[model samples]
Target chain A: MRHILSVTVENEPGVLSRVAGLFSGRGFNIESLNVGPTLDTGVSVMTITTEGDEQIIEQIVKQLRKLITVIKVVDLTDLKSVLREMVLLKVNANDANRAEILRTVDIFRCKVVDVSIDELTIEATGNYEKISAIVGLLTRFGIKEISRSGMVAMKRSIQN
Target chain B: MELTGAQILLECLKREGVEVLFGFPGGAVIDIYNELPNTSLKHVLVRHEQAAIHAADGFARASGKVGCCLVTSGPGATNTVTGIATAYMDSIPVVILTGQVPTPLIGNDAFQEVDIVGITRPCTKHNYLVKDVRELAHVIRQAFYLARSGRPGPVLVDLPKDVMQVKTKFVWPDDVKMRSYNPNCKPHSGQIKKVAQLIRDAERPIIYAGGGVITSKAHESLTWLAKNLHIPVTATLMGLGCFPGDDKLWLGMLGMHGTYAANMAINNADLVLAVGARFDDRVTGKVSTFAPMAKLVHIDIDPTSIQKNVSVHVPLVSDCRLALEALKEELAPSLAEYDFEAGHMPWVTKVGVWGKEHPLNYQASETTIKPQSVVEKIHEITKGEAVICTEVGQHQMWTAQFYRFNEPNCFLSSGGLGTMGYGFPAAIGAQFARPDKMVIDIAGDGSIQMNIQEMATSVCNNLGVKIVILNNGYLGMVRQWQELFYKKNYCSTCMDAQPDFVKLAEAYGAAGFRITDPGDLDRVLRQALDTPGTVIVDVRVEREENVYPMVPAGASLTDMLLV
Candidate 1:
């Protein structure tokens, strides 16, 4: 089963290494990780995705909480949540394939962030599946370069 | 008033009630050593950096306080790694202070520079490298806090030389507030109720305890519960002395090299109440078949320990003492409902049969001494009142099997890391912690020489520690393995050219004794114990002795090689 953990940690040196070291040292496989400064200046939030059974996931969360620099850890696996991943792909787009690429991008609700004489840089932000689909389509045209920001997720607010 | 980082470090240590520190001076810590005499903290200068940490570890285990050590940078910092790992493995609370090259030269590959913090990150519970002088006191406080806090383990504070020399105002914090590292000390009330119900309903229940019981000082609660429930208690190597070895309910130590009765009992048990013990591979043997009949109830403070190697039916994460106390309270209401005596008698009878059928026994020859006889004599002389430390291998097993420990913290050994040369320095530390109690290090010929230089530290300080070396002319445990598994092809297990241990002891200004006959073992041990200072007794035992009831690697606990 796949699980997402939202971890908040103090913005300090070696905090990330401590968090990463716990997972690696214990042989827990980390699927994806996205980390950045949070709204508070002295704190950072990390969204980690991993695959494990209930027992393994529970152990991972508990181990994460054991780090002194870590402030809080929440398993968003069971909660109603929204997840997103962003990918910037540069595809070879000559006259023959430019229209077809734009049509596919429209279908995925993505934007052409940059364009050159023989290349088009497409930017897509959505759930992993959608981003992956766009990348798959762009692969038909030669993908010159690619970069992805790993999954970032949060609990869906119950405003409705 | 302003103070240098070195001054602040001393002030903070004194505030924490630290009277003694074990360390070796080096270039990186010159400033701290310069300021050492200004403070009242007495430092025991160790010959090797590794012994410094081991001594501190032994002190911590004996005193139930965080042990502290200081070492210089580069090789000095690296030497403490094994000791730190040993402490981490056993969950001993130790604070290691390592000197680092100046902050400006940290990554410049300057002389005597190593990233101590980076090196110890995985082994330590927490570690710090103070780049600023203002953070010195706070980091020191945090180091102690983390070292002694929940599920205690070693923590390192790497102090760069420049930071030590910088001046800053020292402000000691009244409290340490770590929001994330709060360990759940109290077990949930509902979980306690469930566990109590299981205990009431269990017909073939066994209490499998470990070092956590000693760490939490939960012997009274554990004893109360075991006595009330009429349950048999089995312990791991580290868990020895947590329960009275003389008690009728005791099944002796369990796992690899454990007694036949303990392994058989755990294998046959239907309900295993595992307290403060992880299911280590050595204890479990073949994990798939270990306690296959039992529905386990694991109570541990560290969440990661539960369901780590084996899945538990009920996992209660809390301090062992707290959990046991809560379970006792919960068991009170239902105590009258269950007829424990009638229900548990049959199981107890079966376990007793197993114990009687395969008791731990060894024949003592009239001409040549056996290692077990030496330990048995030591036990008789000390009456299980002395603090006993052991190095790894066959001697350690003999000590664990033969020594009857009735109190917590009485048995200190490298149970987790199984580090050799751990016993002597550890005994020195234990003596320091318990000045009135007799402390002894039961060592092997192969193990004692690893840190034999510590005899100087012991003699200089008048620690009065006794070292009993079982001189078997071989790395006995590895030799046993070679004899059993490798067709008697002993490779590097032979130590034919060892030193004259008695003379070596005398050279360090300590008394020494040698015994070759079984009859002389008791008298020599008594004489050594009566001596005013440290004494080393070299007992030449049977060269081919082996620890029996052996569970072959990857074999089921039930399949034991009993000779």
Candidate 2:
């Protein structure tokens, strides 16, 4: 199972590398990782997605909590949350295939972000499964290239 | 006042109230070595890098403060890796600093250059690579904060050579910027009551204490809780000193080589209250069969440790000190009715009978001083005030068996890592941490030589450590195993020519004593203890002596074959 760990750490030089070093050195395979500054000036939030057995995940979280720079670590797999992923796919498209691609795009609710003589770039945002399915349907027209921002998640606000 | 990075390091150390540092000097760390002459801080120069770190670990374990070690990069830093990992596993506070090949040559893979920060990240609580000269003071301060705070583990700082040379204005931070390192020490009152109620109703209650009790300084509270609740106390290897061995209520250690009665008691107990102990596999064999009749109550400062090993019925996430105190208070009012009963008296009597039957008897000869005799004599002379450190193998087990540790932190051994050559350096570290107390390393010939280089450190720093070496001509422990399982195929366990440790000590500018006769055991120990600096007692013992009452690894705890 994939477990998402949300960690807050002090923003300082080499902090990111230290965190990455910990995972790699300990032989923990990180599936996906995203880190950026939060509202706080000196604190940064890192959302790391790791696939491991329950015990391994628990060990990883426990060890991560021991890091001095880390402020808080929350395993969000058990919480009610919203998870999102973004994927940009450029597919072969001309008048011949454009109508079929547009129909497929409309079904997946994807917006065409760019267009060229031989290709069209469709931007889609949703859960990973949804993006993968849309990309699978558009592959018939020949996928020119693809870029994906891995899963990012947070606990949905109670009011929402 | 102008300050160098070395001086800034000293001031940072002073703020953390560190009085001693164990290390060795090399070309890269010469700046710190030069600055050492001008400071009040005492630096112990171990012969090997590994011993320095072990000694630092011993200091931390003995003093409940962050222990510090300094070394140069590359081999010096690499050597301490095992020691650092050992401290990390046992949760002892240690801060290690390695001088690097100047910043310019770091990435060039210059001579004596090693990525100490990257190497030690997993084994350390945290680590810093000092790139900017201005960050030295802050990094040093941070090292201490990370080491001694929260769960308490080793932290390392790799200082580039150029950074040490660059002159920097220094100011120690009153508090570091670790927003996430807060360790929860406060006991939840609700959980305390639940534990107390469970203890109150337990027909057969046992309290299993581990090293955390010693680390948290919760001996008094633990004893109070055990006594107030009329609970039997069993210690893990690390927990040996938490409860007085001579105390009637103490059930001795629990696990593989643990007493039969202690294991039986834990096996039959209705409730097992574990304080600061992780149920290591060595302690709990055949997990499905272990303590089958008991419901576990685990109280640890680290929340993850509570249910990591054994399934716990009640988990209290708090420091041992606070939880124990709270448990004592809650159980104090109604505890009298549950005081020691006739059933446990049989166990006490049975052990007493076993002692009388076995008598810890070892034959004394005219030509050699028996290791057992030396241990007994030390115990008689020290009156249990001295702390004993032991290296791994036969001597470690023998020390654990023979020496009665009546106080917590009185026994320091590499129980988790089982590292050889750990004794002398650890004793040096323990002695420096507690200058007023007597510290001795009960080491075997094979184990002592692994880190015997530490004699230099003891002598140079005037650590006042006493090393009582049980010098058998062979690796006695391995020989015993070979004798038992390998048809006496000794292979290479035998030593051809042993260095005269007496001369070795003298070479290091320290005192030396020789114990050829068993009659001189007491006198030799007393003399060594009275000496101002380090002393090595090379005791010739029977080469075939073995530590017994060991249940072979695959066998049940009850399947011990006594030799």
Candidate 3:
């Protein structure tokens, strides 16, 4: 199963490498990762998505906590959580299927950020499943380009 | 002040307070070497890139700090794979910096280009291929952090030549934030109590200590638990020195070359309390048969390590130190009135008789001393206080059989990987980690040459590490195998006669000695012990002696074939 870990760590030198190091060192695979400053100074929030068993995830968290620079770790996947991702995809939608693509975008509450006679670029944000479904629907429309901002997540409640 | 990526690499190293580096330079790494002249860090040029990394590993093991090694691209980086793997297996903390081909040539396979990040992935704790100069400082800093933080192991950074050449403004990050790399040292109290209860109920209990005891500084706890409970103790190769060799409860090493009594104890014990040690195949010897009679109680800092290799009955995944502390609490109350006299005497006597008969016996020629005798003499001189490091092969086995290590982390060697050229650098690391203690490298002839270039590291650093080479004329262990299994076909087991180790040491400005006479063993060892600087003792030992009590590979520990 995939595990999403949201970690708050001391904003210091070598933290990201340490995280990546832990994964690669132990031979764990990281599917995606995103990091940014959190609400507090000298603290950054990192959301890491990886696939492993309960033991491996526990080991990863335990090892991460051993670093003096790491402050806390939260397995967002294990908690009730809110997640978001921003993706800007440029697709070939100009003269061929512009009307069909616009209609599809409207149905999914997505926006047409850029447009040309032959192309209509789409911007959409939702949960991972929703995003994948949107991308899956667009695949039949002769998609030209795609990109994703892995995942950024937080718990649903203040208690976590 | 703003700095270039190269400067930032040096600056971050400075911030980490790294004083010295061991490595060789080449075209790709020339830029970093060029930047070195302006920094306060000292770099030692070694003969081989592998030796350089091993030297850094030695420093790390000795000092409890991350050791640093630098190498250029392709072959230079490839040469370090063995040393990196050695560190990974032994859990030594080291940061390896390898130069890479220019970014444009990375995929083109230009001259001296290698996919180092890919090659070293499994061997390293983590690795990076830096394409952007802006991330150089963060990468280097993170390498150090990851290398030294928890269950410490080697980390690699492959810097593309282009990134090194590119000029960029550098700002040292105030902090590094990563969600996936937290390390915890604390043990759970409840789990510890359950383990203590198991230990209390265990009638035939044994403590299996590994290198973690030394790494966690839990020697006192191990000693206390063994003595208070009257439990016999056995060690994995990494666990040597966790308890005094002179202690009656000490059953020496437990595994392929382990004693029969130790193996029996592990096999028959009701509870096997394994602390700080991983159940490596070399130690388990046919995992299914290992400790067949025992219910395993495993305690380790890394939770994933528990039950990964061998099944555990009671698993308390925590640091050895914390687990020991918590165990002390639970054991203090439930402990029954124990009488060591009746239960331990017969076993002690049997081992004593075995020791006297075996006596680590070997033949010493009039012109050549025996390596076993040299080890015995060293043990005699130091009273086993010295921290001994060894390379792999027959000599490592001989050391395990003869040397009586009484403290934890006092004996360092390559057990799982069994890598050669591990001795000198690991000893250097061990010495650096514990400067007040005497550190010696007991290496075989074949093993020494594998990383002999580190003479420069010792010479430059002025570390008083004693290097004792058991100079048998052939690759002793492999030669033994040939004689036993291949009808003495010999093959390429013979060395290039012998290297002039005395002249070699002198060339590096270190003192050297060659002991060909067994009579002079005691006298020469005394002088080496008194010498202030590093001394290389090239003892000419018998060329054909084999380490006995061998269980071969893939055999049960109970089955042994002696020469």
The Cα RMSD across the true interface for model 3 is: 6.2
The alpha-carbon deviation from the true structure for residue B53 of candidate 3, after best TM-score superposition, in angstroms, is 0.7
Supply the global lDDT for candidate 2: 0.81
Misplaced by over 4 Å in model 1 are: B333-339
Ten contiguous residues minimizing lDDT sum, candidate 1 chain B = B175-184
Question: On residues A63-145, what C-alpha lDDT tens digit does candidate 1 reach at each position?
Answer: 88888898999998888889999999999999998999999989999999999999999999998789878888789799999
Model 2 CAPRI rating: acceptable
Instruction: Give the per-prediction TM-score of chain B.
Output: 0.99, 0.91, 0.90
lDDT of 1 by residue, B257-301 (tens): 889999999999999999999999999999999999998999999
lDDT string for model 3 (B295-363, tens) is 899888776677677768888777788789778876776455545445545544655565455444566
lDDT, residue B109, candidate 1 = 93
Q: Please report the candidate that would top DockQ against the real structure.
A: 1
Query: Predicted candidate 1: interface RMSD?
Result: 1.3
Kindly indicate the candidate among 2 and 3 with the higher DockQ.
Answer: 2
Per-residue CA lDDT of candidate 2, range B196-310, in tens? 8887677777888988888888999988766655577888888888988887777767777666667767777788899989888767766667788888999888877866776
- Order the candidates by lDDT, highest first — what do you get? 1, 2, 3
True-structure RMSD, every candidate: 1.6, 3.7, 7.1
lDDT of 3 by residue, A1-160 (tens): 8988898887865678777877887788898889998777789988888888876777777666654456788888868888887677777775657778888899989988888766678899988888888898888877778878878997876654
